[model samples]
Target: MAAGQHFFGPWDYVVLVIVLLISASIGVYYRFTGGKQKTMQEYLLADKNMSIIPVAFSLMASFMSAITLLGVSSENYTFGIQFIVINISYGIFTPVAAYLYLPVFFKLQATSAYEYLERRFGKASRLAASLSYTLQMTLYMGVVLYAPALALEALTGISKVAAILSVGLVCTFYSTIGGMKAVLITDVFQSLLMFAAVFSVIIYAVIDKGSFDEIWNIAERGNRTDLLNFNPDPTERHSWFSLIIGGGITFLSLYAVNQTQVQRYLTVKDLKRAQTALWLNWPILTCLSLSTSFSGLAIYSKYAACDPVKAKVINSPDQLMPLYVVDTMGDIPGLSGLFVAGIFSASLSTVSAAVNSLAAVTIEDYYKPLYKSIFGKSLSEKTIAIQSKLIALLFGLLCLAVAFLAQFLGGVLQASLTIFGVVGGPLLALFTLGMFTTTANEKGSLFGLLCGISFALWMAFGNPKPPLPALPVTTEGCSSVFTNVTVVAEPQLTRATTQQQEYFWLYKVSYLYNGVFGLLSTYIIGYVASLVINKIKGVSTQNLDPHLFITPIARRLERTMDIPLNTKELSDSQEELNGKYEVNGKY
Candidate 1:
């Protein structure tokens, strides 16, 4: 902590302020530019004509929030680099999102992802899924907004309230005023800062340790460099099986079908560009993920001899990276500021995405439908456009309030990610059931979603689960400068307690597998329930849109199942064919 203990310097403050001003300026720039964001389409989907690069970056930035920057590093620092294996899952699941799920949403051209559910199953299913997504993003954004604030508090002596407000309000301003176009463009900028922030830690650590290999060697000696584990046990944390299979499903949940990303995909002019953007996201996301994981080991190398938590230097692992930056790099003007700005950018990119996507969902799923049902007609697009901004503002505020409560939710990485798994798995399952299976009915999908969420929540929070073990650390190397400070011995879970746990088996399963449990439970239960419901009610499963299902499955179903393709429902015009009917011809 002696390297540079003065916190943010004048240059650092300038860098941080400049970043915020620029982010806000982008929104104001787009507010008065082309189309002026007055139409719902322009406001939410960037008029459906955005470029591939920005859209690609936006897709990556949407979920790769401050949580990833802080949590992943802490995860690596405390646990090990085995978590990096999740990056491979991102690459493996990219096509599943691009080919299997993206095409359905792209062809449908729905503003909200859940709208496809209405077309495929029924309105009830659409509403159910939309509600689930709203809850998921709300909880996730709370953690996103809170992470940087926590860091700023730890590093700069700023109150968490001030830190949260400074970042959250700026994000809300740009997101509400600039709309999706602003979000996409700002995401590209913010994503670079995110990279710069992570690289600062790695570069500093490498310089301090004298080489990158030395960092890895130190991590290896500390038992933090193991990247391959073939254990089949789901309860064994960080196994290859859990990181791949479980992480892959989590990737598909976010990229393939999440409204935040699917909306970004639709910003492009054609499906080809959108898919290209999605494919490009894989590398960008993996690059950041792998870099962040290494940054953890980088920070670990700094404190390998004297553990921070054991020495009472920091209260939590989430504070490690920020503490490392201020302790080691703060003497250099604007360096710590650049890192803080990067952290802020991560939170801004993610929160803005959530704000926009949640607004889209609110309008398309709840507001419009409820209005139509009550007023017996739809509102004008101009009115809806105005309301959309207001909705975005309100959601932004809601997330800000939730950020205050996120401290109670445990570690940012696991808590934010668990929110995805608990909600994402079933939502992915619901969509897959409709798109992949011909027999899935609306009632059955809803039933399975409810059941899946209930079980996943129970698994996540039902019992007093055993604490996860971390690599051993020693405070013996701590100097006499703090001899008065008592060093508490890190707790040990002996074999007696480790071997006989009273917690439920499901509760003991790795958090990585929470989504898998939800996905499997929902898919299996929904499929079986659909069969029973369809059988009892004699529900007709014919005259369905072939384009509504996944391309390969729809083609197979049409070839063998004798179900009508419903081509006449779509017009004979080439624009309609290309826009909506995918199975008829490729995009």
Candidate 2:
């Protein structure tokens, strides 16, 4: 086979088309057969009738996108196994999401998670959180949609624009028509396909390489198996501190407050079932993460001696997995197509979820209030449902526009995580203030959100120098060598001198800590600001509801202060007793 050529056969194309058809068919089936989505609840929450297994699978599908499938392999191939710490961090935080945050939203029966913000703080706080989520998910959807297309164009010799358009259009069709049901049902199918694709690559790589021991031996020798780096340096990219502490905060932002996961949590029948679904996601997420990490190790084993980067077979680490798929599985007919379909499945599930969530936030948080205030009337259910579909369509187009520009970003995993940290951090802080503390007023929450965003942006893009490119590797084991190929040397860095130390200390923080920094900054600043305001105005915190705090914290405060914390229950009973007294007086 010649270099720079793809080997997709006619059968492969047929298989790809079949995958696309099945996704579209599910949408059509739901549109005609499923009952009409007459209200926001039915349209966005699947009528709150979703079962545990499908919701669990849908949650996994939403969280693990094409970025995880391709980027995780590439990350492991380049940086080693330290990325696995994310799974450990998730294990610790998923339950926090279930018990700490889920009950509040569930008890409130929230359509948008930001609705809780409105009740606890004010409308301004709610709008800030809602808009922040919209921006974050919009940016993320573009990368998710672009990743597979970028890989496909590199491996299959197809047009990048064509791949992006097809993915965006098909996802939009289903999500807009069938609503949440289509997204959920299709997600279950896609999740299974994703597992199959990853398993196939690992199984084939092991068979072709002779044994698992041999693969492990090759990776260990190549320095791809190193796991723990306990270095305490904040600027080091993948240290234990960075991955565990930084990653724990990052996952909290993702699972606890992000609209996508919250929407999934709201779909189940009851709080018990929702909690069960949250716990069930753990094993599935673990399986997927391990599969991708091992697949990366397998790739390293296959190309250990003849690095594709040095051979000029692939341009970037992200392209390595696609090159492997086409070169190794292309001859297997439909197998190559199934793998590509799996990549598309990952992309579609993520983008569709984003579109649906974006639409829900825009209508519920932004549009409904603005429209009512201006017109002095609420929108009918039919009109609101139609508007929601149109909003989904608009967001799909916006995602495509952003996809074209995503090529300029760094690696998929880095870009996605950075966006989550910088955007999601502030939003999570707002929700934390509302749920965890009663003294945080609307002014404090809004101030904290703004400051958190500003600080995160400065930390992320404050430095002027561009990042150094990754160092090159070797291809000494290949059968044939081409002349006139030169490997680029790694760039050297100079120590900072007194004259060069102009930037602030915070500017030097790693991207991994963006979430931690953002969360702490927002909370601290907001709390301090609230204290100052209370001192100046002589405002009292006595009327603030204690139930808004975490249950244990609220209970402890009640016992210490000798105050009643069951305000809602007490108020109901007091009203009933007053009616009895009035009746006795009348007699």
Candidate 3:
């Protein structure tokens, strides 16, 4: 585990080069063979004709970044299988997204998910949601880029900055040129690569570590297999309630409101296919989580005697998977390269999806409207398509710049969930209020969104004090026969802090609950404010647009209040409403 001790050899370099070159070549292929991306729809949505399988795989690729691959294993190694609660959360929420959220966007034929905000509320609401999403993705992309770069730097002795730039440039190239089509195509390949790379490690670990019983014995004895913790404490990081409820809210924010995911849903040609694609993601993601979690146990079994952290072989838990791969697979030539390539694949897929979605939102939500207002004319399809490419390039560079900042952040899993809670939570709340209720008005939503964001930020970053670090564990169970050399332990220093261990009440809330708090805060505030405004202004709820609410909500209101819910009339009215906004270039 010394510096450059298990660096990639020549064949490994060949494998890595092949993976990068194939990704770039996909971009070239789409640029030349797919014809010109003359319209925003073509560039951003792949003309909405994408098939179910590729889109499903692309969703998997986007969802399972290097952080999931590396961080999940690290988590299992450190905390046991309780992290599987996240997958359970996904299982519960993906259907909610498909049934409740997907139809609204699909029915509107909206280019941007935030566009529905404009149609339902006003331009200000749309801008608020879109800006929040753009910021979230931009920040998350940095962590996505940084994770693989850090891993590769350890595995192949490549400079971390170089690894980040290589991924950034390649993803940007294909994504800018080929747009969503190339991104999805490459994602399919990357997903397969990820499966291969992970399974190879698992297969090798099984062979090296003996039968499943032995590995399970080692892991169970080390307290790595505990799956269910029903602790009800809100402050506890991983509990059944936190993981189920908090994790459900977190996943809902991603699958329902996040632009990266919505963009994938919009790529398909029909609602049925889109729903099918979403269903496909569950099993794929579940398998991946189980595989990596098992890999963690295998890693624990392999290193049962000599704890790398205690031995000073690695600085953090995130580095454990890479260390294990290098130690176990170093003699297998191109295997290390494939593993690095797999990490890069995960990073590239996630970043490319972010870049493409960011560009789409920039044009559809911001640029197109501004250009029309100032110039008093719409830009041609060709010009808009070109602008989209430039926007992708710009955002890709921005991601690289911010990636340098991620090195100072905490573990990848916690950092990413915190970002989701801080940004995605408020965004999800705004959309939920708009889509589920007819009473929420523009002024109310705007106020609620601002307040939600401020509160979430306080919860995420208001604490100035760091928690005490846990004590390191010994590797006494690891067989002495594996290592005969005497290893010296370095003295560890502890810091005693007399500063009062006080924190703002909000700061003590687990990051897992940020989304639920933000969602409820925004909706309740917005709904109440709208009721007051309606009472003062004497506005009639009966006269409001029914399409502003979800189908079930609208139907329930019709039953309860005897309000006539005319489906055809509502469809026509919504079409006309969006048409009016589109004509003004404010859609």
Candidate 4:
């Protein structure tokens, strides 16, 4: 690897430091001024008075970060235009979350969405989900820090280990001190920079090549023909069926039930704003995914034929995006700075969000319950926040520690993503079954979640090299990176491919599929266990009230289902509902 003198220019460092100081300054001001909000409602939901536009965009921006920026783009670089199809998941599944889970969550108006699992199924179900979510989120938060750190590590000579502390510390400061208001508001700025970084890469890519069409032709040559094959083959990796069904379930679980996302929905001033935010998130994410993918395409056009891997500096496709920036645009004073701005932008917003949300969950779900159990139901927000911040610090340190786990392994983006999905699969099912089906009682929910998680570990990461089938890649005219470059896996391109191959069977299990598997098992096992537990524990599925689970649209469709909608009795939950809500109406 060729190494050179590396430094961020004075102007660039100034911009970076100024960004950090500005965020910290706002944190200090808000800590005193608008920071009077110390109640659980204030900390977790922002007093539920946030304007719709910023709230919705915050949700979009928070959800869309370096993870998606690097993730989908890397997928595209490695997989081709095939990765573009994730938009289908974001577009359809997000609104599905709005309709399916939002109705119950809003109706219950619980601070933590997992609270419903306890109320509806039982405490065991909630514990199962909460513990799993904490695990999922901790690892996820680590990646949030870890991913952008990869970008900075490649850019600056700083070790990946040190980059994490720098990123984690600043984010922890804002998130711990500023709370959700700080997180959502600052996220707006981060989102803007996030787009700037992506679009800047695009602009630089276009400037170097002249026109989009010219770049497309160059990129098309490096494309894999099989990448675009969208057959519903059971064994194919990332097939259309897997992308839609598997991706849909994962999105549904993650967006609908996860406290991190639910916490964002609470920031909306009213349900109306929540609804608006929910509706807006789909297309915004869809567009963001496409933009990142194009950024990868840009990287491919410049280096795919040369097969930069052949050059040895960038052995993996994931590194190609960052390397392209350094090689092509780094000479400009802040171009490297701009990319880092984008990187930190993406990392900082999400990391702060994680810290705040984790604090919320710890206080409400875990700490509060323990407090009540140990003493009584009366714990002040001040006490909870202090405990929560301490948890946040510990959580931050744990995430920082986990970030190093990936460094030992080679830079493989898909492996990281799939590892997350495999573990998260079971948790997704617990929430899905709790909200979707009345038959899944507490016992069933717990059993199903455990079963689903156990199975996922066995399937996705159980074996070394994973006996799963490989997707095809087009490399007919591909030059060996130095001829010493090892050929590991075949590639695939989208439709209009120049080559073809049979789909592999074992690949029926993509990471996304884990969500479906978990959701299904939770339902199936939940019902069976309900009977056994009902006998032993004297439980009652008989009282599984349809009213608790129905949606606004379901009210309109109730006539056909024989479930009567009483407008008068809706008053019981009305006081909980704000006049500003986003629902169609509770029947």
RMSD of each: 3.9, 5.2, 3.4, 6.4
The Cα error of candidate 4 at residue 362, in Å, is: 1.4
Better of 2 and 4 by lDDT: 2
**RMSD (Cα, Å) of candidate 1?**
3.9
> Model 1, 1-587: lDDT tens per residue?
54224478899999998988888788778878957977889888889889999998888888886888899999999999999899889888888888788877876777999988877777788888999999999988888888999789877888889988987887777678778898899899999999998998999888888999999999999999887788999988788999999899889899888888888988998778988998898889999999999999998888887777778776678988898888888789998888888888778878888888999999999999899999999999889989988999999999889989998878898887788999999999999998998889888888998999998898887768877878887777666322344666767988886686576777779898889999999999999999999889887666556778888777875675544444333323425443443221122
TM-scores of the candidates are: 0.93, 0.91, 0.92, 0.86
Question: Which ten contiguous residues of candidate 3 have the minimum total lDDT?
Answer: 578-587
Candidate 2 per-residue lDDT, tens place, 1-587, comes to: 34577878888888988997897788677666666676778788988888999888888888687888888999888888778877888788888888888766765566888877766776778898888888888888888888898677765787889988887887777667867877889899889889988888899899998998888888888777777688898877787888878888888888878888888888887778998998898889889998999998898877776777767766778887887888777788888888888998778878888899999999989999999999999999999999998999999998889988887767888888888889878878888877787567788778988999999988876775334324235767554432344445435665643235444666666688888888888988888887777677776665343445566666765565544655345444543332332110121
lDDT of 4 by residue, 449-550 (tens): 788777766665543433333223333334542233444554676686755544333333566666566666656776677666656776444434344564
Clashing pairs in 3: 304-478, 305-478
Which candidate model has the greater lDDT, 1 or 4?
A: 1
Better model by lDDT: candidate 1 vs candidate 2: 1
TM-score of model 1 relative to the true fold? 0.93
Best by lDDT: 1
